[model samples]
Target: MDPPTRSWSIYNRTEITQRYEILERIGSGAYSDVYRARRLSDDLIIALKEIHDYQSAFREIEALEILQKSPNIIVLHEYFWREEEDAVLVLEFLKTDLASVIREAKRNWENGISVGEIKWWMIQILHGLDACHRNSIVHRDLKPANLLISSDVVLKLADFGQSRILLEPGFVTGDEHTHPHEQNTPSQTWMLQQPETIPESDNSNQEQITMSKEEYFKELDDLKAKDSVDETDKETNFNDGDTSCLATYTTSDMEDNPFKSSYSYEAESEGDRSGALTSCVGTRWFRAPELLYGSMDYGQDIDLWSLGCIFAELLSLKPLFPGTSDIDQISRIISTLGNLTEEAWPGCSKLPDYGKISFGKIENPLGLEAYLPNRSSDEIHLVRRLVCYDPASRATAMELLHDKYLNVNPLPVPVNELRVPSTNNGQDESSPGQWRDYKDMDSDSDFEEFGTVDASTTGTGFSIHL
Candidate 1:
């Protein structure tokens, strides 16, 4: 098959070509394509992410810059952007991600991942997420695919395209307990707007304006507050409580019901602050229940729900809730954890599409124990903390780090002691050409082979299987 089309003219640019040897394309998505390249300056292997969407690029850049100091977060060396061109981000490259590790274990290990190794992975994930949460950033998309592992067996969080920095009321630094979405208005705008145009200049000499943490948060607060007021006014006449005026459903409504009401999940366009934050941001299998109900108003607790799903997958070497569509996703969730109700999660009825969608009540829900029969009680408790119906009751990353499960005698293994597969997709990485050939193959094919869906490719949601 012919190689996928390159939307960005990154290969032809003199500045990019001179600085990094574009080795091969490793991953692709609707708005971005990632390449495994060698830095010309230091011969260091790196990933060059060419993002076609200005909003996504800006968000990733801003989030990574704030998280550069954290060891568990991916390092953004630098980025290159110019007028009317795609942004190219220079990022650290890792041989494999947690998905690959899980796949390898399922194939090779007789008993699946060891308890100690699982603890190590969980510890790393918690640390990375703790760093993000501490900075008031929500990694809307968190799955095994996004949790990349380094050569030293260290896991770091990657792919911040869907991540949002909480600059609104409860999300400011030092206010950890307050839920971010409690007081959030429907008019709150995204902080990373299209940047002002810079004068035409050579890429090598382009200078970046770094904003201090204090100044950055201050500016974000001012922007969000201003946008909220302006949008509230524009929407005053149209903000009636009736939901009939919203975008109507289509023929595919049963398959993937589009969220288009005042609580629509569509991200606002460049100059349009009328749309609500998308609830359809994450992959289907790991998505939180509130998100499935089209709740645009949510907080970092959503990540905790995803963490529970990921942990369950690691234990069984199979996805806990591998749904095919949005509706199917909720069915699978209900089948396992019982039907969602106001008693379980108070105010859940206030969710955008909560009334629009309905499900038969499950009389006897099979708990996590049904899926993880042989697992230890502590292990079950660990997943239980984050997989509950109430978002407020979900455990935080910091709190889980100190849990009894992680502090036991068979504690988490050292980073160096953790095992990682030597080869990715049967390609020996010791050979540069072989590694390049492996990376050149489309990532979707690999995902299909493993019965997993790459969330990056599907703009909607995704799933995973054994």
Candidate 2:
């Protein structure tokens, strides 16, 4: 069969080299490399992400295109794609991520992260996730490293390579394999613009501390309403000429990389692509119980479990469950939350590998309080809302936004007040290690290899594909 054909050549390496000056390599993984670059026309810095895997590139482009309008989500200025060439995405540059902030707090702060700062970070994260969830997009990989912080102190959700779109019930498509950018026009340029600053709260309202919880919630409601109106006005005032679908070029070739040898650009039928949706995808430490049981069907709730783990880390300055392997991860979870049973999750026993894996019963569990000894009851309750065994019981991002803890006194601080850590030219050097991508396997037999390999040997986090 002839290989699938691209509709048009968006942009090539020559155009990219002429338009942007490549600064330095900021991050790299098995499937992609991110570089800090400056757009020549306006001297604005941006991130150029070159993805080697076709599937990953397509997924990230589709997800970012749908979410580019959201202030809390990373902006995708444009992308370049061509047959037999790696897809390069032009994205907003962020100096650091939440992982860096947590690390700095642990090292520099004697008392740890302030309550107001924690609330601010949590709010921004929820806003980003709410945008994704509202669009029916599930960010299967939601971790600190993926939540990037800009120089303006604004937090945006980055790294949508592992994202998936869930069709509404009864919805169907005529061409399931169609590429998202196939119908777009040939390359055009997007004018560079300075990053907008997040509005700061007025200090004149210091007396807000004396207000009741009900009044405080009302004040926040009004603030959000005003912000929504302001966003609408900005959208209305935007110039059409400033935004266009454009592409950048890169000269690097991946043909010699051993990891690039297995990738295929062939288009698969809808039936063949069905398995891709259910594949095991996520960092092991923050993965949900259903995923660990080899369940083929899961949803956005899996991200909530990861959020819980991240929030716990923020509070304590360490991972909530730092399991060395998949088995260890499960054991740690059970030891904290008790044995998995029908009582906690009615349909859990029906999971694909439920019968294959077993653990000794734990009459009593350690609970979240034991690990979070210094946190308040309210803070502990917030984590419990998301870390539960049942996916259905997990709190939605919108619901969490209105939680009493965020609305009460000592509310989230302004964006400028956030203590953002310095980074080496937009690169996060404090990351524990790079994320290793495993080759995709269609058989259930490969599940045994999950997290079995020592992370130290690979110098990467425990990640697998099944």
Best by lDDT: 1
Q: Can you write out model 2's per-residue Cα lDDT over 183-209, one digit (the tens) per residue?
A: 121112322211222112432311113
Segments of candidate 1 deviating more than 4 angstroms: 1-8, 168-276, 426-466
RMSD to native for every prediction? 12.5, 15.4
lDDT of 1 by residue, 1-466 (tens): 2234644578866677888888767554445567778889889988787776555565677777666667898877767765546678778887666766776787678878899999999999999999888878888778776787776777889878767776633344634432222121111221211121222342233333345546544544454443312343432211111111011111232112111111111334223332236675666667899988877778899999989999998999877876545555676788788878999889988888676655666788898899998999999999999999899999999899999999997988777777787533332235333223222111111223432332232333333221
Candidate 2, poorest ten consecutive residues by summed lDDT: 238-247
Per-candidate total of colliding backbone pairs: 1, 1
lDDT of 2: 0.63
Candidate 2's C-alpha runs over 4 A off are 1-12, 168-271, 274-276, 424-466
TM-scores for all candidates: the values are 0.72, 0.70
> After superposition on all CA atoms, how large is the RMSD of candidate 1?
12.5
